[model samples]
Target: MCKNIQLLNDDFLQDPYRDYAHVREECPVYWHEATAYWWLTRYDDVHFALRQPQFKSARLHALFDGIAPERLSRFTPLTRLLESRLLLTDGANHQRLRSLISTAFAPRHMDLIRPVIRQVIEDLLGEMQGRTSVEFIREFADPLPSRVITRILGLPAEHYEQFKSWTNDIYQFMGVSPVDRTTRAEIASTAAVEIERYLDRQLDDCAVGGGPNLLSVLKSASEAGERLSRTEIIANVVGLLNAGHETTTNLLGNGMYLLLTHAEQAQLLSHDRSLWPSFVEEVLRYESPVQIIARQLSEATEMHGVPLPAGANVLLFLGAANRDPRLFWQANQFDIQRQGARHLAFGFGPHFCIGAALARMITVEAFACLSKVWRSPRLAVTPRWRSYPVFRGLVDLQLHVTWQ
Candidate 1:
């Protein structure tokens, strides 16, 4: 049953949906021996697992033992920071941190940044004016959210390039294979240490002279007058800086790819302005920015009649769940008009991405601007896909643009 479910298969990497279809139909809750993680593909199973407390997010500790046990000391900085992130915490700790930081993403704050988002998009398009062929990821998709994130965090926009380098180092370790992880972890640890020290200074400055930024927002945030510690604040900020732009970058690149490939569907948005929201939703569902997320079972549990042992890791295939025919009609087809069950692209339950609203707004503004400015955009060459199983995005996309 699991013969066709090869996670590292070349054909599977190119188009995972085909393999996902096979697994979802044949073995919705199958074990992947190579990775030693239970694969959950059905929408209900994935959704249920995400909400249950037993399926804990705090699983990074296993990375140390599983990857390179002797290299534990080397990954100290990286592991320490990662383990503190709200994304990896649960229960009261996760709630407290999520609530405090969520103030920065409140609708009011996002509303204030709407014009800024549009301006960034316009400026990026402006830069594309002379070029007939534009590398969409590097020239536009990557920088848009980087600029936005820096603005939201009140950091100097000039530091974005450096920030990207640091975050990519960390991301590489998180996504790379075990064979390469030890080296990646060392690089990631160095990057983490540097970023932490940088954030420490920023936090000090914020404490002394408060500003209208995420740091300030977090500083003042309190739950029942209980506040975030200095370490907790810095750790979550690291998460923000990394997650804030990374997913948005994927959304833009992925959405653009879909739009370029599906000409008729792409044109539908221009004719009917109302389709913008659904367009974004469909983009998220069709080619989710975050393809897979993991949760370790805190204790033994049963899922879909399968008994999972304690401490078992389950890989929730959000991409597969989004395309599950059980919930969505003609699930594999890309149709903005079709809407029934909501997509788990941002995930479901407590760990649902808090920056989702900001991501959606950025995507809407971006495509809206591109529609008006690019005139007619089409793929210049076959886009290169990032091979990581956890995140779905293009490495680079070249677009043949008729600049308006």
Candidate 2:
């Protein structure tokens, strides 16, 4: 039954939670022949797999090395960039990169940025005033994070539009089922070069007595005896830019979709604003922005009585793990009030998302603002989900919102 699961197909993209539920029940540890990866759907399996030393994130370099030269040539730049990203490395290299980058992304710094995030949200909401219908993704969801992240990174406000485009291109190359790998690679490579150059200029500027933003903070860390090379700095800055906005954008869009569809839940939260944080958590569990996380086996192992060979690619279905009935009561049902269990939306263990705090802050503020301003917001049209296999988000979320 698991062998037949087509994760990249339209049916799966349209409705993966239902399929994942079926797979989790029938075969928790399933091998996907099409993509040549093992799919782990159960909560315990995925939770353990993430922290297991044998399942490594840095194996992509080895995996790509075995592919045909012609096929691999196009991905050279992307692979190189991925190799540098903290998310794709392991062991000492991963630690070094993560530690250096962590300074700029510290929780205290994120808290300091809260006021600015609130202002950004306010400005975005202000634009929607007097409007009966608005496209949530473009008007609110997209710009809020994009603007905030750009400001945090010290990038000029004028480049926000370009930054969004570049990040989208980069994500396409990194997507689970990208449309036309050749095209995506070209766009991603070009964007990579341009973004790196931009970061280089920022680094140069920060070298002369740093300023207030993240780039300056990173520079301070570098000057304070950290062994961060220029390439590592560029890689992390690019990583932060891409990782910073995309997931949060999806979270906001997916959250709104959940709220609008579950009108009772929306009304409940609107009246009681204190539930916004819990509502965000439930939205993450219900429709995780990132549907899957990849790992590669370092050695032969048996998981859940199923034997897996060495060098095997593994896909941890976070979307499924979050919905596993064993973990949460009424897992399939979206309940903002439910609490206790932590979801894998920001992932788990050592490689947990560094931007989780910032994402949470932005989401809490966004929801708080929406609940206060928007009255009886309902879906204007059926939400169109993006077709990326690993990302669960709406392409456009049109809502008919009555201003309070």
Candidate 3:
């Protein structure tokens, strides 16, 4: 319980960068008694924790065992499903899962899907023809990724709205610290079961030689003697659907927020389409969609001269690391042209985002379309951010855009 360190408060929520900067400068690795976890704020420390083998990601099982013992039985199906997800595992299992899933999300696959993504973007923007103002999150940011992922998963187009709702409920459990763990877990488990059943049905159909969707790819890999199990397939499909939808949705929303606030950078990018790639990277670095990631220490270790015992939960603040002055010059500034803007927005090492390519492709095309079709897009009202500690995304971005 460090008196000087405080998160989970309004100030931190409103401007987390300021709090993160202070922590990086004052105490790089401080223990928060309130949350019962160690905070890693500096760039080097967070980076090391992410890549270090000793900091394991497979502790969620143990973590939940301690948090809600009464609800454990009810959550077993969901827990087992999550444990089978590639993101929650490490080492050999993680590698195997990643390799199998990578086939469906390969760079070449993303390239092949680029035209489809562009068409979706064009159709979305086209729908805004007679609009003076639009709720960007609903109209464009949120729906784009949801629709794209649903299409990729070979789900019915009519189910896109339901898919988005399910993913949102799951994210509410996954991303935020819930006040009532019992209730949240119950709701999330319900969603997880529904998703699993749907995916399970899809897998059954794909097993009988269905279309060439992501589920079919995973099914083929499994039948071809891969170590992937049916449970793992269902869990990872749920993972892919959630990851594919939520993060990209946030990226588009946050990127537009950054560009709108930094008028000069927006103007620069609007005039020069070539900078969209770098601009996308800058948006990732500036206001990373996924902010905090947690890791458990596998062995007793010393970081910044502070001894930490094995099994200690460490929260690596990726958002803080991205803005660490040691890593980026003028870290707080949003300069798209800034060279060497390497960041951990998608994380690092073995656990880097599997859909990074797809997310970037979606974002790049999003900005390209906006640059071409929208003129002087500005915030129509003050934007509201979602109150999730781990995810930094806007609830809605109302904007006034003139048709070009």
Candidate 4:
């Protein structure tokens, strides 16, 4: 079957959900010849595709092998950093690392961080007080989690500035050719090395000092008397640091953007007050930051009536799937009253995001407080999108708001 296809455009960054909706209803699975990758639309299809463990995630190493092994050998250091953790691994290795990180994210520890979290949030708002115009992403969205992460990792707050820089650098790591990738890759790779080395020293101290933090908790993980290696701990921390904040930041930013645009939805939540959590969930379903996720096929499997051949790369268009007309009523509309928790934004099955609960809590608290206080909020300039195949959301958003 021939399906009409268009290459990913810059406009997708500004508003991708709309772009994905049209594609999902028209062409469920579209193949791009130039990119040599298949793109799948429809949320339920993506959900079922991800649920199959027979389809391997670890097969994504091809992303970096765009160059010959000899050429990429020089950039090995950078490659290693990006490919770290359970995020880059699959099967039992992924499970083991996830278990260690999950313990730190337990209900008990998240509650422990709540007060500090609120104080940090208030401190951010304090800085923005009386400013008639503010860039929400710069002032609020980007820094909140970086600040929280530094404290969670037991690093000093001053380092949050550098952490933000390093994370931003890492964010730019994808979608470059072998040469440019090599250049930017070094800076990001060097930062990853330094972070791991820094954590190594901290982990050693926690082992001896018995400090109560994420590092301390992971240090105590065991299986048949085998503790986590320094590399494994670093990988998990990198995974946590990357996962812990950035998506939440986008979720908050994207959700706020939606509410501001859809005044009725915004007003509904504003009036009810108790339904903020549902609103957050709907925002995630409506316009997820992670628009696409791809897994390489290790064996033959069928999805959406197409057989995924062995060694084929399959892309799950999460945004498309979320807006699937078959699964959601008025799927394209942003409805706060939408029921069910079947959205794949946080993923599903084994690779589901471990920080979902923490993310939801932050969004609820931040939006509730901002809604109550901020007098007027409007888009300062049109939010921009990244020029990459992945990560569909605003790269730079300027929202002007006033809080008297």
Candidate 5:
């Protein structure tokens, strides 16, 4: 094993799969500094940790250590708000609420909205007209995710700016300095309150048989003796919006970045579009939008032959898992045509991203629109990625595109 390795360096930050390769080869599950969380690197370890019911999510108020109790207490209401959602809830609450809400995301229902999603992507791409080159991140990725998520909540297009602002606040993690975190947390709470109120109003309207949006879907869920509370409904609404927006945005951005870098792969897929699905899967495996998720030991659990005592906090490194060489030889190689593309990008087991299908469809269509509109795009600025233990993504990257 290499001595005194640090996972939070420039090399790891720029292309973490390299670090994943090292750790998976040497120490599959080694403790790490920086965050001081037990880190899992090998593919099997991460997949097993996520599947094990002994590990639980709705974690410490502060993802970082040494947070004050008083400050942590302030996060309780918000944590409760977070925990009410499907990802945070476990066992029965998770199964029940998810079983009901899962209907909203039924494959047939998602297919119903494909045309709308396609239209939204084309419209967003159309807005990039007149320019031979544009920053694909701003022109394409950002607007595409924001608009699609807004449509999903059935929020009016006029209110999308509010949703955009709210998403920005929620997506903040280790990228911000210590001093800025408090203010960002405050903004997140306030935004959560406002958005929930908007959802509450919509739910109330749907209760009066108003319309058949997601709100109405939740209303029907409640009336069908599912016993969902107002808080639960609010939690689901905010959680979906927060979950869908930036992660999908970054997926679009990073996927584009990857394709733009690998010219031959891009041209190959451009010619035969049926490879789009596997191509997106490989992108998720390669440059995953969600880099990490935290879990606490609900009970004593041994992972990768290392025991995590009950109540011990651990960080599951999704980025590392995607690059585990044991899982895939030449794991660092970004090959769209490769077989067996299972990645931890959407996580695993009970907490797997419920909107994975929707997010996948959105990304596929967004890239499809881009493929139609632009022949090639060169990056203007190297991407500036946010290095948070909780989120893995680029905050911004400029692109210059050439249309045919």
Candidate 6:
């Protein structure tokens, strides 16, 4: 094994697949010297790690462990909020939170939300008329999901920008390195407190003026006569807003980038409308939105002959596993027609993303609209990717398109 494998530099950030391929081949269960986290790259290792009981999901505390004492006090609200989030829970707690939240995301509920998503796509496209070159992330991708999520939560349209800003702050903290996390943690803490207060007020209103919004649905969610606590509702509502939009935004940008760069794949959609769903899956696998998910070992375990002790922090590379050549025939290629693309982009086991269906629906609708209107789409400039370690997305995708 090479000494000091530092994978967080600029080149790796811009394109990490080559590095992933190297690690998967050289050391599938390699430990990072700088970050002190075990990195898993191969498909089987990552898949097994995700499903094994030894690999626990409640690992967010490890992120805050390195902060200074005085500064850490400022993160109490953020810490509480993170711990309460459905993303970080396990076992019975995870089951309970998921059951309640799943009600709002049920198939019937998603059917009701579909028309709203389509309408939002239309409105966003309408605003982009008469422009030859457009920034996809800002003009369309970001707003489509953001608007839909805000509407789903029953928040006012004017608060959309605030919602986006706050979510970005929280995500920034999520994607930052532990050493540099103090500043991001402060920002995220403030965002957490502010959003908690905002949602608390919204929940109060939802209590009195009940509607078809998620707040109302969550407030009413019960299992075995136990309802979600106010803090639980707020924490998960914030999580939904973040997960609801961030990944979808990346999916659209990455999908469009692939289509624009590869004319053949883009043409497949023109011929077969049935390929839209598969297109979403291909984008997800080829360039996963959420690249890395962290976990802590609850007990001693061995992965690919590498001994991992209890409490070890491990980073599962979802993006890398999706492209693992062992599972995928032409893993790196973007083909919408690939069959049985068993990619773990949304993850596996009990902690799988709750908003997966909603994300797929939103991406399908947005891409369908883009395919119809953005004829002969071509990149206006080279695509620039965001520097977030956890999420993979374009900073901006400027494209030249002909309105059909």
Cα lDDT listed for each candidate: 0.83, 0.82, 0.82, 0.72, 0.74, 0.84
Q: Write the per-residue lDDT of candidate 1 for residues 270-387, one digit (tens) a residue.
A: 7998898899999999999899998899899987788999989889999999999999999988898986899999998999998889899999888887887777887889987787
lDDT of 5: 0.74
- TM-score for every candidate vs. truth? 0.94, 0.93, 0.94, 0.90, 0.90, 0.94
Native-to-model Cα distance after best TM-score fit, residue 395 in candidate 3, in Å: 2.5
**Clash count, candidate 1:** 0
Least lDDT summed over 10 consecutive residues: which range in candidate 1?
203-212
- Clash count, candidate 6: 0
Give the poorly placed runs of model 4, Cα more than 4 Å off: 1-4, 17-19, 75-84, 174-179, 207-212, 222-224, 382-386
- 2 against 6, candidate with superior lDDT: 6
- The digit string of per-residue lDDT tens for model 6 on 136-230 reads 89898888888898887777778888977987898778764665778889999999889888888877777524334888788777323656787
lDDT of 3 at 63: 40
User: Roughly what TM-score does model 3 have, to 2 decimal places?
Assistant: 0.94
The stretch of ten residues in a row with the least summed lDDT in candidate 5 is 204-213
TM-score, cand. 5 vs. native? 0.90
- State which candidate has the highest lDDT: 6
Badly placed stretches (over 4 Å) of model 1 are 67-71, 207-212, 222-226
User: Distance from true position, residue 270, model 1, in Å?
Assistant: 1.5
Model 4 lDDT per residue over 1-404, tens place: 54444446656545666667666766676666766667788766787778888767785366565545666666655566655566667888788767776887888777777766687789999998888787887789877877776676666566666766665666556442345665666677777777767767877776423223666767766332565677777766766777667677788788878877898887788679998998988888887867777788778877567666888877788777878878888987899988865778888888898878878887888888888678768888876665554555567667677774
Give the distance in Å from residue 361's predicted Cα in candidate 3 to where it truly belongs: 0.3
**Model 3 over residues 30-83: C-alpha lDDT tens digits?**
988888889998888888898899999997664454355665898877787788
Candidate 1: residue 190 Cα off by (Å):
2.1
Tell me, what's the RMSD of every candidate?
A: 2.1, 2.4, 2.2, 2.7, 2.8, 2.1
Query: Once superposed on the true structure, which residue ranges of model 5 sit more than 4 Å away at CA?
Result: 1-8, 60-77, 171-182, 206-212
Candidate 2 vs candidate 4: which has greater lDDT? 2
In model 2, the runs with Cα more than 4 Å from the true position are 1-3, 62-78, 207-212
